[model samples]
Target: MSPTPQERRAARHQFGTGSDTPAARRGPSGGRKKPITVDAIVDTAFGIVEREGYEALTMRRVANALETGPSSLYAHVVNKEDLDELLIGRLCAEIDLPEPDPACWRQQIVSVCTQLRDQYLRYPGISQAAFAAAPSSVDTLRVGEGLLAILIAGGIEPQPAAWAVDSLSLYVNAYSLEVSLANRRISGSDDNWVVSRGELLRRFAALPETFPHTKRHAAELTAGTVRDRFDFTIGLLIDGLPGARRQP
Candidate 1:
C-alpha cells in the first residue's frame, strides 16, 4: 500500500532530517550491535558509493556494510528507489541557499549549481540517483523552492522561473554525470580510450577532409578547463533568461 501524506511526512522527518535514531541498549544475538537506523543506512550507502562508485551501491551492499541482512534495510527504507531519494535529499540538504538579491541573482544561481555539482561529483555517479529521484522529496523541494524564490525576485515571471529551475537542474545533473563517467574512464586500467587534450587535438587534426571544420577548430574545441566550461554554460543559461539583470 502507498503511504499516506502523514506517513510520508513522518518518514521524511525520521530519515531526511539528519537526526539519528537511538541504538538499542542490547542486541538480539546477545552482542552489542549498533542499531540500524535510516541514518546508518544512508551513511553506509555513501561509504559504498565513495569507495566503489554509485553503481556498487545496493540494499545488499549497504546491509553487508552494516553487518546485517537486506531484509533489515526494509525496516527503515522502502526500497532502492526510496534510498535513491534519500541520498539526493541528503545532498540537497547540504546546499546553502542565499537570500534573493536582484542585482546578484545570476551569481546566486551559479553558486547553487556549483554547490550541487560538487556534491554530485563527490560520490562519483550518484547524480544518476538524482535523475531518478521523485521531485516530492522535501530536501530536494527545498533547493527548488530556493531557486524559484531567487529567480522570481530577479523579475522573472512565475512560469519561466519554474522552467528555469528545471533546466538548471537537468544541466547540472547531466554535466556531473559526464564528468563522473570521464573520471572513471580515466582511472580504469583500460583507459587508453580516454585520451589527453593533446591526443584529442591530434585525433581531430588527423581526421580527413570530411571533417574540415572540426579539424580546423580542434584547438578551440579542446580549450578551457572543466570549470571554465561549466561557468560558461551556466552563464549562457542565466543570461538567456528573460529580464535577467546584468550587473556592471
Candidate 2:
C-alpha cells in the first residue's frame, strides 16, 4: 500500500525527505514490492542516517533498506555526491523563510539559521554533507535568496549581503558539525576522552605561571551552555554587519 499524503508530509519533516512522492513499501516474499523512486531512495537514506548517523549512509545500505541492488539506486540518484545534494536540498526545503522584515531582519536571519542548525543536529554528522553539497541545488538557492533579501532589506549592500549569507551558512554548517561530533564523542564507549567543563576549568587553573591569564580566567573560559555559545556567535555575526539597525 502506498503511503497517504499525510504520511508523506510526516516523513518529509521526520526524515528530511522533502519530496511529495510516496515511498516504496516492502512486501512479503510471495508478493511484489512497490516500485522504487527517487523519493523512496532519499527516504531510505535518511532512515539510515537517523538510526546510525550520516557516516552510515551509503548507496549499498540504502539499496539494502529498499530491498534492491546498489545499481538500482543509480537510476534515480547518480552517485553519492548527488545523494548528498538531495539530502541537503531536503533540509533546506524544511527551512521556512520569513518575508523580508526590515525592522527585524537580523532576527529573521538568525531564526533561519537556527532552523537549519536544528535540522542538521537531528541526524548527527549530516552537516558534513551540507559542506560538500553544491550550492546550485534549487532548495539551497531558495535559502540563499531568502537570506539575501532579508539582508538587503536591512540596509546591507548587495555585495556584503551576499557574502554575509555565505558566512552565515558556513557558520551554521560548521557549528552543527561540531555539535554532532561532540555528541558522538560523549555517547561513544571512549567517552572518557570527552572532558567536562569543570574538568576543563581545573586544567586551566593548573597551568604554569606563564599562563597567568588562563589560570585567573578559568571559570570564564569554561562558561556558557551550547545554546548560549551559538546565540552569542550568531549575534556577533549579525550585529557586526555594516549599517545593521541597532535595536532601541
Candidate 3:
C-alpha cells in the first residue's frame, strides 16, 4: 500500500535525518509541515530581510525558519549572491513600464524611474542587490529596452539612445539607493525621528562665522520633499538631453 500522507512526510524528514519519526517530524506544536520550494526559500529570505534587515539574511536562518537543513537550500540556489540575484529579479518583476511614447518620451522615462524607486522602497533589502546589478536581469532589461525604444522614437541618435538607457538607469538606481539607505537609518519611530522644522533649526544653530554662507542657506539645503528633489534632478537631466529640442 502507498504510504499515508503522514508516512510520506516522515520519509521526507528522514531524508535529511535526525527528526525522522512522526512525533519528531511534527510541525510547530504538531501543526503541519511547511511546504518547501525555490519560491518558498526566496519568500522566507525576504521575510528575514524584512524583519531583521538585510544584514541578517542568511541560509542558516532560512533553514531554521523552514525546519530543514541549509544543505537543502543549496539544491535549489547556488550561493548567497545567487539568492540575492533571484530576490532582485523577483522584485523587478513587480514594476510595470509604460509602452514607448514618442510624443512624451521624457515623461515616460521619468515615470519609469519613479516606478523603479517605488519598487525598491517597497522591498527593503532590494537596493543591496542593486548595488552590483548594473547589467540587470531579464526583467530589468525589458524596462531598459522599452526606455531605449522610447528615446529612439523621440529622434535620439542610436548611440545616445543606448547611452541614455544606461545613464538614466544609473541615475535612478543610485539616487533611489541613496534615499533608501538614509531612510533605513532613521529608527521606525514617529516621535524620535527628526522633524523637518526642528532639523532646520538645529542646522541653523550649528552654523557660525567659520561657515557663514552655509548658515545663511541651511534651510535651502534640506528644504524640499523627496519628490521635489527627484523632480529637480530629472528635470536637469531632461533639459540637457540632445533630443530635447527635437519636434515631437
Number of the top lDDT candidate: 1
For candidate 1, list the clashing residue pairs, or say none: none
lDDT of each: 0.84, 0.82, 0.68
* CA lDDT, candidate 2, residue 150: 92
Q: Which ten residues in a row have the lowest lDDT in candidate 1?
A: 18-27
Tens digits of lDDT, candidate 3, 6-99: 4432343334211212222234543566556667877898888777777788889988887877766665565777677667767666777777
| TM-score (C-alpha, index-matched) for candidate 2 | 0.87
Model 2, runs deviating above 4 Å: 1-31
Please report how far candidate 3 places residue 13 from its true position, in Å: 33
Q: How does candidate 3 score on lDDT?
A: 0.68
lDDT of 2 by residue, 1-248 (tens): 65544454445435554454433344454146777777788788888998899999989899888887776566556578778888888888899999999889889988999999999999888999988554766778889999999999999889888889989999999999889888888888876778999889878978899999989988888899988999999989888889877765
How far residue 27's Cα lies from its native spot in candidate 3, in Å, is 12
Best-to-worst lDDT order = 1, 2, 3
lDDT of 1: 0.84
Candidate 1 vs candidate 2: the TM-score winner is 1
Task: Decide which is better by lDDT, 1 or 3.
Answer: 1
